[model samples]
Target chain A: MIDLFLFGIFPYIALVILIGGSIWRYATKQFTFSSLSSQFLEGRLLFWGSVPWHYGIIVILIGHLIGIFIPSGVMAFNRIPLRLYILEGTALALGLLLMVGLVLLLVRRSTSPRIRRVTSTMDIVLLVALLLQVLSGIGTAVFYRWGSAWFPQTATPYLWSLATFSPKVEYVTSLPLLMQVHTANSFVLLAIFPFTRMVHMLSIPISYLWRPSQIVVWYRRQAR
Target chain B: MDVRAQVATVFHLDKCIGCHTCSIACKNLWTSREGAEYMWLNNVETKPGTGYPTQWEDQTKYQGGWEVKGKSLKLRLGRRLGVLSNLFFNPNLPIMDDYYEPWTYTYEHLFNAPPSSEQPTARPISKVTGKFMDIEAGPNWDDDLGGSPVYARNDPNLADLSDAERAALFRLEQLVFFYIPRICNHCLNPGCLAACPSAAIYKRAEDGIVLVNQDKCRGWRFCVSGCPYKKVYYNWMAGKSEKCILCYPRMETGQAPACFHSCVGRIRYLGVLLYDAERIEEVAKSPETEMVAAQRSLILDPKDPTVIAAARMNGINDEWIGAAKKSPVYRFVKEWALALPLHAEFRTLPTLFYVPPLLPIAASSKRGKYDLTDGEFFSSLEDSRIPIRYMARLFSCGNEEIIKTAIKKLWAVRTYMRAASVGDISDQRATSAMSELGCTPEEAREIARLTSLPRWSDRFVIPPYQREDVIQQLTSPIGHKAQVGFGSNVPVRRGP
Candidate 1:
């Protein structure tokens, strides 16, 4: 009963809160909606912490999405001997990089007084959960080397079944404890995304590169 | 010409007495909060000395302002891509040491100390670390120590001065310095405006005052390094950038800025000048030596019929144009040519001008009788204790001729006044002096009146800011009822 609730009911609850809470925050706390950058307080550690963390997570996320989005093509790509070697090597390297970056960030939060003061309970909770998720993920990938080849055949269909509102717990329920913890932790991260500073990810000004150097926003009309 | 009126200021360096009343007033009014304690939105610096933030003029250290690249102007530090990438770690930003660490004394310890013969004293505590610390530096640590070698010798502006000229400035007998009170220049091309990643910093169209919108500023310290003047500051507590708002809340109500209003020397002159906005980048990218002249040339004469027509066509009402005509800043900067902009070489084309100090005449009283140079009427230019070279470096970017011209005109006015009021010298000397400088006797008297005894309203010719016309643009201006300051009952319009 608990497994059914954790995998089925919890996913819907987390998704609803993530989407609805983020929309509410955007409507109400527009001023507070920011990356909450601690670089101004202690920049040196953040350089190591933020850069590697972002790069590693981004590449890792793309690799995961290939199974759900391009399951058949990825299997064909992974079938090749050299391509599979490269894929697994890249994944292991990025996972280790993500761990180091997360450790440095956690150390900075605990050590830097200025940064520590700004950090909240939610921040620490999120960080711990992320640490657990990363650890479990790396463990399963190491212990089960060709998990991607196996995951698409099992987990992708299970995700599709979940998305299509059909019960197919048999696909992912039989996975090892390490994989189950990683999967469950991701749902918790999604549930708390909007309430914490993580919502700032939606507001990145990536469009600044193409815009003009000097921008003058006129709140009132030029014509008097 | 895209003629528009810009409210400008002039600071008479001769009259400033190094009183930091303006700085305190600005601090008390704006930046006295938790993370803002380190910011001095207004400050007075002693010339021939390193300024606050210790040699902010050394662009090599801060990497601020703009550089004239091959055909265009690029930020001295970095641009679009740099702005985005520096989010992880901004290497160029000034740490708290550059600005003094904000500190507060532990008063509670003194109050709660056990009774003893020795008086318990309050000790300084760090605001950031919340612990006892030895206080080392402050906002104006080298306040009056202008002649001290440690602070004064390292002034970055002294780079252009010849060795002998620098020696003369430091000589015990020839030691001369003047106060230069600084505020954000609200430049024609503000580096801070360009470097803001969120486009949070902007120059207001009504007045040319540059401001940072706290709501939008992500505490990206690019604006801090972006300003050559180093005026923008980050508030670590709230994670936002703050700067001198030019007292816009006050100006919107037809009042002078806090620093200008509180100037003890009455050295500040606030007024408007009609200028061509389209030529801002062209003027900003001019050769460093020619920047002052190029910038001054951008200011169109308000009295010119074509200029007046263009300004009116550009939507400046006649009343604002009238204020620009009577503006004392224009009279000093453009008409009599007494004041010059500070650090035009930065190529920001700063709006604030400084009237270079005239070193008091060299005269000796031997055995009670004063034997001044009677025929010369006044001390010659070479007789000046403060080198013209130093003044030129500060104002004209090594152009001594410009400083000489301003000093000559001021000297002519002084001699001309003495001849008119209490003449020990003949009227012919004053007439010849005025004629040599191409200034009429009437012009000299006008300069004397404005400089010596200006009426308060005359000094601050605040153009009528019609904030009243723009309330309807707000969504539900009266939505908060009496709580909203800008709640208006009328309609407004919009255009870009």
Candidate 2:
């Protein structure tokens, strides 16, 4: 119980604060841009890193949810068996690509002394958290050998317990320590969700779906 | 007879299988370039789940749309941070790993290694942030109540129980959940339209699709801050912002958007409708009852001959109207009045309407603890029982009545959009559009003169070499092949 409270509940509490703090900070920061003429070049590293990393994370998360949520009975429908292979394989591949992209971004930030100067301690901490999540997840994927041992039957029941707030640490501990770490890290990440750059991950792309399509004619201002 | 028309679409959530076929279709058609891989102009997300791009609905956090502080200039909310805000916004962008790490099995290894009895275990070669990051819950997380509605018809916390137990629980709990698939509302008065500091974003004069002029975008990121939906994506690499173009090209050729067309459930509708642009501000400012009623009044009925005439004058087509008549959207938005607009109080006057699904009731539990009269279970199925305060909060100009009335008006807006066709317009309306987009009367006349011209630039122009630079900057940042940045220090070697 203490372990559950400390590792599971306490981390969740911390995650909430971190996430909430990250979001509040980001919001106020964004609110500061009041001028139209001011030009602050956005780092290309931030842009590319944000998009691929975010989108990749989304696909991966969905794939993870499927692995966690779908029942074995449902997996039998519509050649659902094949879907697991395809979805899991796709996730693995995309995850690798995103990992590469993120590394490039990190390298760019570090090597570019100018960017390095601008880099904050919070940025480093956020990076560490993200890196820990990825490393552990990847380790779990590798150790589990990508669904060979029927993890859902074991892991899901425990997850179901958490949903109802009747969590049993033994069920979680029954899995490999790596898996446990992944789960704990995930909750930590969730707790910190509202705080870091991670908050942007919550942005809806709906505007991209229904934005208007009127053409705008601009009169370019020539050099005075 | 005016023939001018605007184009619009309606997406039915039921028909969407979440296959991303439309996303792929749109990607192949437009966003497949180096700078666009991360962008999903078309993406489908299960509600209750964090949507693609994350917490997109709550504008207070992500900061999208338009803000009207300056002389209506466009800016990026992220870049606009104050010096203090900058310190706070550090790495305003979440690291790639922070979002999620990417990984893949070595293809060569997979190809060479023989599979075991089970599928060959995939191993990761190189990995970035390899695990899932936070940012999961959505804006309506508490109310979304997703999952198999039938299974949990009575209980808020859907659980696995015996049939008898479930039935017993149902009598006591008597709860229901609905699936609401939504897309861009293409509001009548778009916050994004008003928030642009550069006057770069505009609503279509014909159908009402709002878009940003890429070339005109100075990357102020104001839209990022002002829009409540946070749908706009800043192309940091391009020094611009990009959003949904409503498949204008497809609409021009008379087809639904990729997502709507590709929807396996066939729940989408496409058309056009005329609205009184003049009365928008007045309607928006009035009391909730008047606001909703006024909003509803703006919805022009295509069946009304006068409305049809006005529509035709704007370039709407009969085919569009006919399709709209059969449209599921019309039934949901207008007739049954089940669908409603999202966040209407923001008062951008969104166009998309969603019909909340009616899931069946589960069997009764424990006779009737809440209300047991004899052997019969009490019907906890009253629509009134569902707290509509959230709905009201989304659309009630200031009061609940606005949401109540917006139901009918949004239905009307759906009617108009279902009939408007691209370029199927009256010459007069074309001229009006030209004027609105800042073309001189002579230029408008010239465009009209060349209406038959086969070739024209469909995409808005970027400054000379701007498009090339944007692509370079987005795909290869710093050292990744094509470095795209200010080449200030590099000396041009002239011929000695």
What are the per-residue Cα lDDT tens digits for candidate 1 across A1-224? 87787787788889899999889877755556556667766878998998888778878988889888889987998989899888777887889999999999999999988778667787788788888988988898799878777668877887788899885776667888887788778889999998887766775767667767655444455563
lDDT of 2 by residue, B46-67 (tens): 4433344444554444544433
Candidate 1, residues B1-496, lDDT tens digits: the string is 7775678899988789989999998888777666678889999988777887888988999888989889989888776787677665677787777778889998997899999999999999888778788888888877776436888889888887789888877776556677789999888789898887777787866568888765566566688888989899877665667788787667666778888899888989999988998898999888877877888899999999999999887778888899999999999999888899988888887889988887686455557666555336667898786677777878997888888999999898998999989897689988998999899988998988988899889899998877655542333322422220233222110100
DockQ of 2: 0.03
Residue A106 lDDT, candidate 2, scale 0-100? 71
Say which candidate scores most in TM-score.
Answer: 1
Error of 1 at B332 (Å): 1.9
Model 2 TM-score is 0.45
Q: Please identify model 1 stretches exceeding 4 Å from their true place.
A: A62-68, A147-162, A165-171, A217-224, B361-386, B422-428, B472-496
Model 2: CA > 4 A from native? A1-108, A111-224, B1-6, B12-35, B63-109, B112-178, B236-239, B286-292, B303-338, B363-387, B390-496
